[model samples]
Target: MGAAPFPAGILIAAVVFHATVVLSSFPATFHLERGITANYKLKLSKLKERDRVRHGRMLQSSGVGVVDFPVQGTFDPFLVGLYYTRLQLGTPPRDFYVQIDTGSDVLWVSCGSCNGCPVNSGLHIPLNFFDPGSSPTASLISCSDQRCSLGLQSSDSVCSAQNNLCGYNFQYGDGSGTSGYYVSDLLHFDTVLGGSVMNNSSAPIVFGCSALQTGDLTKSDRAVDGIFGFGQQDMSVVSQLASQGISPRAFSHCLKGDDSGGGILVLGEIVEPNIVYTPLVPSQPHYNLNMQSISVNGQTLAIDPSVFGTSSSQGTIIDSGTTLAYLAEAAYDPFISAITSIVSPSVRPYLSKGNHCYLISSRVVLRCGALAFRKFRVKG
Candidate 1:
């Protein structure tokens, strides 16, 4: 089967749109911060003001064109997709900056008793822990309650009658994990009305208040208030708002390159005439897409179709939380070989960790129209 072509005149912009948080306002905008690098330092590059705007689109697109909710985001040289939004929590809401992730379901924040929570961040921004006791609107979720059952699976419902506080435990692929209980409180953010005009609104949202963290979550430089999960799970802030009839329960984001300030995140269906819609793989926990072929510079790599087939444990997942792209061994070898065979021998190639790197001190310039993603098309 042939892949559906994108609409004519529709430029598939490099800015990838996604969503991670939901607000009470019809259209809301949050300024994002590029997360700190693993080395605990901020990467700043000086560029011409016109060059910045030329290579990147500003929050001005939030109201018109292909964008709606225009949220400004900072740049992180280390991790390209680490975007966060600053919002308030509690009766008299205190501001917090939390990383936006789409691979998980729960919205969790480090609490006052966080054992491994960081006190400082490399982003040069102040970090604060959530104090549930300080918020009069805050309430503990009990294990016996229906909301607790909503969070747990039928087989995992082992509630303690003696202590009814609903508990949550989450583990990441990087050997990092967090454990804590749940709480409901007022979540506040601004809604974009017209152009930069925003109005404030608040809603009661149930989120995890983590008290313990391990691995990178404990690192002060990488830690923020917590993570805002925007997965498809019903427990996500998006689903919670939709269940309450908040605003049709939809959202989108446009992820910009490092040179750009960041991209827009809107809360509605995007109607792009030039957009091509692909069917998602069903019965999967995460967003999985069917990949048909792989190509580079318009040349399809010589690889078997079975190499891309789904196994019991491995499959194609579209996760924004992931910082890098990894190809299976069968496909990676030929992919690199093809690229190296075409390059000039004058540029010496060396192995750097797991990558084939070239030593180029001279400024090599390519035209704006040059370079393209793999020619492999995706189909059902």
Candidate 2:
């Protein structure tokens, strides 16, 4: 089984626990990134697919908003792409599917009267718009509220001219953005109590109520209800739960490579596993890691030493939103050359635009596959 980059940093393979208490079930909704799989089986070029993946990651990483609530869900690796989970927002508790990403923070959903929001989606899930008026528990956050000011990282908080509601404008690196205001409402989800029994739970969360969207955010084939950011921060769902003593400060997710629909996400620590721990780079935005060097088949790649330097600005972030591994130009050239040189004789390499495509047997696939994952020690 191939291991991908996980921000959570632990892998608990094939462990099932029986509950003495009511176990919470936060079932994850998994789907491939755009172009990974098509229900109609339409063939897309490799370059196009790569672009779609890149675009998705750029959007996912650039999400900035204000919301907090811990959620648990698992994803299927059938398509080997992105994974998402469903969240219930509002008093009646309408379900909305959002991408499960650790690179960004804050959870925002498309609200009613949203401009450029997708009317339909290819994932076959109904994209419901949230209306604060419909939910009895929902209320608009005022500009003078402490939660609204606490969530703002900088001077980006813009209140109404009449001192009414607080507004937020979340922008991406690619110029795409979401403009909305803040709202507070109850979020419904399943919480594990003791062992086997699951309990229904609800939390009061503050999240972005998007009124307008631009650029690729408007697409239908690749659209979902919105995005859920799981990044480490005071406003993230995990931190919010820890503050309330609802759960511990640690979490884990086990994503199965097989499409068997068997995966697990635990919000608290698992005491049985004696896994070694690595220190995280402190005060960084994402799950940044100081990768020492790159090794291939017992041989380390000869590259510039500064390329792997551990710094706040120049480290690697394990992002689940990314569809494939992206290396810097200095690393990409040498890595590609080494791999292609070894397999050139056996496999006839062809190009779909600039991408190298090859046909190989099952044996070669196993030999070339690499496994990598991250583990973190969550402390209160």
Judging by lDDT against the true structure, name the best candidate. 1
Tens digits of lDDT, candidate 1, 1-380: 01233454542223222445547676875645434333442212212222233322322223322113333344342432366666688978887877777778778888997888888887666798898899999999888778777567422223556777888888887689888888899877544323232346677888888889998888765557788777777777777766765433556766765445556565445544576788778877777778777786789998888777665566677665554455776677788788777777775556644356665446653321122112223333
Which 10-residue window in model 1 sums to the lowest lDDT?
Answer: 367-376
- Residue 30, model 2: Cα distance from true site in angstroms: 40
Error of 2 at 9 (Å): 37
Clashes of each: 8, 14
252, model 1: CA deviation in Å? 0.6
**What's the lDDT for all of these models?**
0.63, 0.62
Off by over 4 Å in 2: 1-80, 154-156, 173-175, 196-198, 259-262, 274-276, 350-353, 359-380
